[model samples]
Target: MDSLAGLVHGFSAAAQPEFLLYALFGVLVGTAVGVLPGIGPAMTLALLMPITYQLEPTAAIIVFAGIYYGGMYGGSTTSILLNTPGESASIVTALEGNLMAKAGRGAAALATAAIGSFVAGTIATMALTLAAPGLAEVAVRLGPVDYVAVMVVAFLTVGALLGASVLRGLAALGLGLIIGLVGVDGISGQSRYTFGLPVLGDGIDVVLVAVGLFAVGEGLYVASRLRHDPPELIKIGANRMSREDVGRSWPSWLRGTMIGFPIGTIPAGGADLATFLSYAAERKLAKGKRRAEFGNGAIEGVAGPEAANNAAAAGVLVPLLTLGLPTTATAAMMVAAFQRYQIAPGPQLFAENSALVWTLIASLYIGNVMLLVLNLPLVGIWVTILQIPRPYLYAGILLFAALGAFAVNFTPADVFLLLVIGLIGFFMRRYGYPVAPMVVGLILGPIFERQLRRALAIAEGDPLTLISSPFAVLVYAALVIIFVVSAWLRRRRSAASV
Candidate 1:
């Protein structure tokens, strides 16, 4: 009842004229960026985080939340019309969506994707609204050792499950941990890795690292792969769907929502696995004729995976808001955004900032509606956005990245650091190293360290105390279960692919 009342108040607050405009702007920009090749929401949020530093917290939160959802919606458009998916979660969408486009059913494909996203996203946000508060309440009772256990789960899952290989992911995470430990220790007042530089006294700003790795690094990498001619985008023909298409799509949307939301809430991984699972499930459930269409351009293939992708996106927010754990790269950037506003997203967040949290939640509902309205009517605009020249697009990305980095403290040093980190990011990508674990590590390392120290201090430095609590034991046990299950899932998926 209290949560419902708070949500009502949040709707009232979020419905204010100014806030509505911010939501519109965020969705517009987010959809635009999501349509562009090689630019994901993580990079867009990183670029915007520094730029949004001066806005009121509520407004910024609304905008970020809009981008979060809008990007999820827009990626389907790219996967369908363009040569490749803008993000990995959309890879499954591309498999069927692109086929649909080539087969001249692009309109039906896009329609189902847009509508499925709306359905799944709306349902999943409702789930988030109800679930987050209860989780926070339960999380409030947790001890430092429990938090340490949770962070360990976060570290292992994000590093091992997200990328091409576990070793590379762990290596990237180590790099981030090293960068995060550069400044003077808050408790001990001693710097560990500053290398005796005056600038090291303050530590490297997260804004620089984020903007550098995502925006600058992505820009440079894309630039290296730029072609002389723009890749052709499939024309989206009369954007409408048949009644038969609707019947085919609705069940998949619901099934995908069920599959995606639960996967999202857990620390197992992000939307990629959820999408694949949904795709496989839909293929299995299809009847004789529909099964024949699976590899070509089945509407179910376009609908279910897209729905799963969006639902998983909503699910990723659960751990982020309630426990301050980021399962996805974008969630990590969101944590950085919260930290910039001096807001931490753990259990205390609800009691301390109920209004803000509820408002953010409500705005998600509003954003879903806005995304559906915006995406359908403006398909032409998105097609134009997709056709943007690689050179100019990348140049603008780097320029915007530089400006955002410089705005961190308006210091040249920040810009220089941005470039240096960007170069490293380019190398990381070039060598197939995952950057997400690095960002997650950079953001969560200090919190993990703090919790570990407190847990040890309370135990008089006895390491065995780490697993003494029942909750901590459950968490660690869950980690082992997740690893074993994930390994089996991988092998099964590989066999199916073969």
Candidate 2:
């Protein structure tokens, strides 16, 4: 009942004219970025972060949330039409979506993607709203040690699960820790990695890193791989789906949402994980004729992955809202935005900023609807964006990257750092090192360190006390079991394949 009341209040707040307009703007920008190759919502949001400083916190968050959903919707467009995935989560969609397009079922693929996203978004949003308050209540009881343990789990999980190799992921995480160590020490007030540079006293800006890695690095990588082959636009068939297509997709959407939402809310679980799992689930449940279409372009393949992507995106908000823990790069950026606004998420957020939290939740539903409406009718327009010349598109991306990075601090040093980081990012990508974990590490490292220190202080330097709490011990046990079981299963699967 209390949650219901809060939601009602949230709806009232989201209904305001200014908030609605911002939501629409966010969806528009997000969809555009998502549809375009080599651009993502994280980069788009980072580019907009400085500008958002002028808006109210609630409105800014509402807009950001809108972009998050809209980006997922737009990402599928490229995958289906151009055989290019705009976001990592859309990679699975490309497999079947592009096949469907080549087979002249492009309209069906696009419609399924859009409709599945809407259904998944709606269901996941409801799950977020209902689950968030309860989780927040549980989080309110956690001590410093518990918080430290939770963060360690998050760090380990993110680092281990993000990349092809745990070693590379940890290496990226170590780099982020090194970056986090640059500022003045919170406890001793001693500058560790500042190297006598005054600007380093405040630490590297998160926005700078985000823009450098996501925007500049991504643009440069794409430029280097630029092919002269003009993208063949998939012919648009009837935009409307037949009853048979609808029947096949609706169940897949539901099943994908069910699989995706819970997994996405877990530590180290994001859209990538969710989509893969959903694809597997769909494959497992597929009937005789449909089963044969697993590798080929099946409507279910496009539908399930698209649904999972949207559902996982919505589910990421659960931890962000309840514990101030960001499960994805975009969520990490949103954490930075919260800090810029002097707003702390977590259990206290619900108590202190109920209106803000609820309103943001409410806005997600509105955003999903807006995206569906925008995507379905504007499919042709989005596909037209693919005609943009590679050089011009990349040039524009580089320009935005420069402007966004410069906006962070207006310093020449920051620009130099952006270039340096961008170069590093380029190398990392070339070597198959995942960039997501590095951003996660950079964002979460400081928080983990702070909580660890606080826990130690409370424990009077007794190391055992760090895991003495029941919750901490339980979580650690779970982590150990998961790692061992997962490793064992992988070995078994490899042996069986051999």
Candidate 3:
């Protein structure tokens, strides 16, 4: 009953003229960026941080939340039409979506993806509304040692789950931790890793890292792959789904949401894993003809994973809101946004700023509706984004990347750093290393250090205090179990291949 009233209040707040306008603007921009090949929600939010610094807190959050969800809706468009995935989460969508397009069912594929995203997002947002407050209640009781344990689990999962190789994920995480450790020590006044550079004292801006890696690096990588041969675009002949299509997809949407929401709430439950799990689930559940369509362009393939992707997106918000843990790149960027407004999202957030939290939650429902409306009949319009020439598109992206970097402090040094980081990002991509763990590592490393220091301080410099609590012990045990299981599976797979 309390959750119901809270949602009603949130809806009332979200319905305000100013909030509605920001919600609309956010989804629009978010969908547009999602349609673009190189930019993901994290990069888009980072690029827009300068503008958000000038807005009211509620409006800024509404907008950022919209973009985060809207990007999920927009990614399927490129995947189905161009066989190019805008985000790693959408990669599964392309496997079946592009095949559907090739089979002249492009419209159905897009329709299912857009609609499935709506169903999953709406259901998952409701789950978030009901679950977040309760989770925050539980989280409030946890001590600093427990929180540190949670962070460790998050660190382990981020490194283990994101990419093809666990070693590479750990390597990327190590790099991020190194970057995060630079600059003046927060607890002590001593400078660290400054290399005699004045700007290093403030540490590198998360915005610069996000933009350089996602936008600039992506542009360079795409530009390198540009050839004289024009890519083929699958045409959307009929944009309507058959009655059978509707029947087939609705159940998958629900199941995918079921699979996605719970996993997303976990500290390491990323969309990449959620989508894959949803795909595998759907494949396993299908019978005869439907099962055979797994390799073909099956509508179920598009529906289930896309639904899982969106649900997982909503699930990412749960931990972000309740525990102040960011499981996804966009969620990590949002933490920076909260810090910018002098607000921290955690257990205390609900007690201190309940209205803003509810309003942000309310806007998600509105954003989901807006994305469906914008994507459905207007499929042709969104696909037109793909028509832009690579040279021009990439050049514009690089220009904006530079502009966004300079906007941080109007510093030429930041721009130089952006270029250097962009080059590093390009190589990371070229080598098949996942970029997200690096970002996650940089964001979480400082938090981990802060908690570690506090824990030791409370324990009078006893290192054992970290794993002393029952909760801490359980978390560490889980981490070790996961690491061992993952390694065993990898070795088994390797041996079978041999």
Candidate 4:
């Protein structure tokens, strides 16, 4: 009953005209970025930081949440139509999504993705609403050592799970740690890697790195590949799914929601993992004609994974809101945004900013409905966006990338730094290194170090004190189990292939 009243109050707060406008704006921008290759929600949110910083805290978060959902929805369009998954989570969707497009059921594929996202998003958001308070209460009692252990687990899992090779993921993480360590030491009051440059004294801005890597680097790569022929686009046919299609998708959507929400709540459970798991589960569950259609145009393929992707996105917010822990790059950027307003997220958030938290939650419900409507009826419009000329598209992207970077501090040096970082990002992409681990590492590196140091300081500099607590011990044990299981699975898969 308390939860019901709080939700009702939240709906009232979020229904304000201005808040609704912000939500709409966020969804539109998020969809645009998601449809464009290489520009994910993290970069879009980072680039918009300057603009969104001026807004009220609740409003800013509402917009950011909208962008988060919009980006997830928009990625399915590109994955099905272009065979280019906009978000890594959508990669599993493309496994059969593009084939569905080729088979002329592109409309059905897209419908399933859009509706599944809505169903899963709504279910997961409700789960977040009910579970977040309990999680926050648990998080409030955790000690610094436990937090350090949690960070270590997150770091190890993110590094291990993201890229094709664990070595590559670790390498990217190391680079991020180095980049994060560039600024003045918060504890020691000493500059570390300024290189005598005044700009470097403040350290590299997270926004600059995100823009350079996600926007400028992608623009440059796209420009280089402009000479290649564009992929053939499938024309829109029936947008409505048949009764059979609807029946097949609903169960998969429910299962995906069940699978995704719990995984997302975990420190290492990301959208990519959830989507792949959902896909595998769906494939296993399918029988008869559906089983034969796995390699062909399978509607279940698009429905299940897309649902899981959106659900996992919602799950990430649970940790971010309840514990102030960011589980994804997008969540990391959101932490930066929250810090900009000096509104720390955690147990205190609900106590001090209950209105803001509740309103944000309610707005998510509204945004999900909005995204479903926008994605379904107007998909043709989004597809037409693909017809945009590459030269102009990339040129505009470069312009915005430069402008967004410069807007950070109104300094020319930021522009130069963006270019340098862009070049680095290009090479990283060329070499098959994943950008996400590096981004995650850069964001979490400082938090991990700070927690570890604090834990040690309290224990009189004993390193073993970091895991003395039962909670810390449990976290470490989980990390070890994850590593062992992952290694064994890899070995078995290799043996089977051979």
Candidate 5:
């Protein structure tokens, strides 16, 4: 079926009351996670993955879709009112939104953010709906060699673009590759990295790795940096937008969506780049009266970044659905979730699991509306959630991390393994290493190995055959271009800084 017909089918499947409730619950949890500082969607998804064990695949997926987008909108509350960004992408939101709130234009900031997210999300979802089906058709024609190329792009970009330094990101990716390769070899059925232990032969569970790195690891890292004082919050007045606010924000919203969705679909960093680009665009475009507001509580800054952040989130789903390429940490966790159900997301996904894919797309549309409704009128509630002490918040996360690890196989060994991984995560954070590339590598490494093996077998062990395919050559060329461009950009920035 075509995209439009598939969407109709999706709406039919997802519009049921039960699925709606699941979506609602997911958004509520996601929003709360965003409101709480130091907790991110990846960690939230990791901690709550046990829910997938209880609910059916469709229900669990619907809820998760809600959480994904809701988290995007949820950060607006804390970023604006408390100046504490819950996630890296929201850092820009706090930059301008907090100023607005401190100036007692808190209501206007919140209004623009909520409405702008809605506008961007809805438009981006429309783009996804139209774009994904055709992309899936193209992806279906790709061979194993082409898949290897795509995965290489995913790995190289993820490793090079994430974290404080390229070396740190690559190191994290290497660690994940090592851990992912621990199980018995699928082709030979021989133990590879088990070290003669039966437990190692089974390989570490994805749940354990995810919870350790995101939940337990983060908890430990944050605990090491706890402060004695609580942060003061700005009191928000009535949450409503003025006509002038609407006039200024609409253009920024459109521009941010235009900038964000395309970036989200690529591997060159996701929402972070989109937000920065949008912020720059808004600043450059601001006219006479608006120019002076750039540093102090500019509504355009908040509106544009917030819109881009949400639109980029929608854009991320495109590659994930069509090529099984996850561009972010949360997207990697989503891949893990798909694997849990033995449902691979890629070219054949639409042909084999059409129902599931369509329903998921439909849920995105529902989730957009749900978040707008949830965020607009409930500003005070989220602010209240933001006041939660970091100690209690992380304590609960650690507890859930333990529970999730133990629940994996009801084994104490898994829990121990979780702690070991968590410690690694702590050290990574302490040393300016990023955990996202590791998660992406951990999830994609197996897929890459399998694809590589398949390609090699087809070529009868000829290494040159790997690059013989035109698509593979193109992918590598693109990789080189990205690297060169990024390096040049870095040099330019350094020169300007000097």
Candidate 6:
């Protein structure tokens, strides 16, 4: 009943003309960025961060949230039409979607993706609405030690889950932590890694790192791999689904949402994992006749992964709102947005700014409906965007990256830092390091440091106090179990190979 009342109040706030306009604007820009190959929601949000400072807090956040989900909706269009995936989460969709397109069923593939996204997004938003407040209530009671434990959990989970290898993930995380420590020490009032450089005194901006790693690095990588053969654009002959298509896809959408949303809400269970799990689930559930279509452009393949992607996107917001813990790179950028607005997201955010929280939740549902409407009839338009020359598109993105970096501080030194970081980002990508963990490490490192200092102060420099609290002990135990299991699994795989 309380949840119901809260949602109703939230709708009232979201329904305001101003907030609705921001939501619409956000989705429109988000879709555009998502349609462009190699650009994901995190980069898009980071690029727009400077401009958002001019808007009201509610309006800016609404737009950011809209972009988060809208990017998921638009990511599928590129994978299906151009055989290019805009986001990693959409790669699974391309396996089946592009094949369906080649078979002259592009329309049905796109339609199923759009409809499945709507269904999954709607259900997942409702789950977030109901789950967030309860989580926030519990989070508010946590001590500094517990907070440190939570940060450790985030670090371990994200490090273990994102990369192809655990060592690579930890290395990326360590790099981020090192970058994060470059600025002035908050407590000691002394320089750490600045090395007499004034620009390094403030530490590197998160936006610069985000844009460089995702936008610049990804763009350069794609440019380097660009082929002389022009991408074959798939035509959408009939943008409608048949009854048979509907029958094939409806169950997959439901199953994918069921598989995705729960996993997404858990820490480190991001859209990539959710979509992969959903694809595996759908493949396993297939029987004798349908099993053959698993790799050859089945409608179920497109529908299920698309549903899972959107569902996981919604699920990721649960922790962001309740505990202020960002589960994905995009969520971390959103946290950065909150800090920009001087609005901290956590238990205090809900207590003092309930209207903002509720309104943002309501806008998610509205945005989901808007995405369905925009994606369905506008599929042809978005596909047409891919017809633009790759050289021009990438050049424009680089220009935006430069402009956004300059906007942050108007300093020439910042521009220099941007180029330096972009080079680092390029090497990181070439080495197959997971960029998300680096960003998470940079963003959370400071918070973790603060909590550690506070906890030590409370215990008179007794480091053991970190594990003295019951909650902290439990969290550390869970971390140990995760590490042990991961090691055992690696050993088992090694033995099997031998």
Maximum-TM-score candidate: 1
On lDDT, the candidate that comes out on top is 1
| lDDT for each residue of candidate 2 in 1-498, tens digit (9 for 90 to 100) | 999999999989898899999999999989988998878888888778877778999998988888888889999999988888998889889988999888888999999999999999999999998999999999999988998888877788777777678888878878877887778888899888888989788999888888788878877887898788887777877646899999999999999899789878976558987787788778779989999997788899989989999999989999988888887878887887887788988889999999899999889988988988988888889888888898998888778778777777888888888999899888887787777778878877888888888888888899998879999999898788757755664464356436
Of models 4 and 5, which has the larger lDDT? Answer: 5
Candidate 6, residue 28: lDDT: 82
Looking at model 2, which ten-residue stretch has the lowest summed lDDT? 488-497
lDDT of 1 at 194: 84
Q: Which lDDT value does model 5 have at 105?
A: 91
Q: Where in model 6 is the C-alpha error above 4 Å?
A: 480-498
User: What is candidate 5's lDDT per residue for 121-169, written digit by digit as tens?
Assistant: 9999999988988999999999999999999999988898887699989
Question: Regarding TM-score, does 1 or 5 come out ahead?
Answer: 1
Whole-model Cα lDDT of every candidate shown, in order: 0.91, 0.86, 0.86, 0.85, 0.89, 0.85
- Expressed as tens digits, the lDDT of each residue in 114-154 for candidate 1 is 99999999999999999999999999999999999999999
Candidate 5 Cα misplacement greater than 4 A, ranges? 488-498
Q: Against the correct fold, how does model 6 do in TM-score?
A: 0.94
Global CA lDDT of candidate 5, please? 0.89
RMSD in angstroms between candidate 4 and the native structure over all alpha carbons: 2.1
- TM values, all candidates: 0.99, 0.96, 0.95, 0.94, 0.97, 0.94
For every model in order, what is the number of clashing pairs? 0, 0, 0, 0, 0, 0
Sorted on lDDT, best first, the list reads 1, 5, 3, 2, 6, 4
- Looking at model 1, report the run of 10 residues with the lowest lDDT sum: 231-240
Q: Candidate 3: deviation at residue 126, Å? A: 0.7
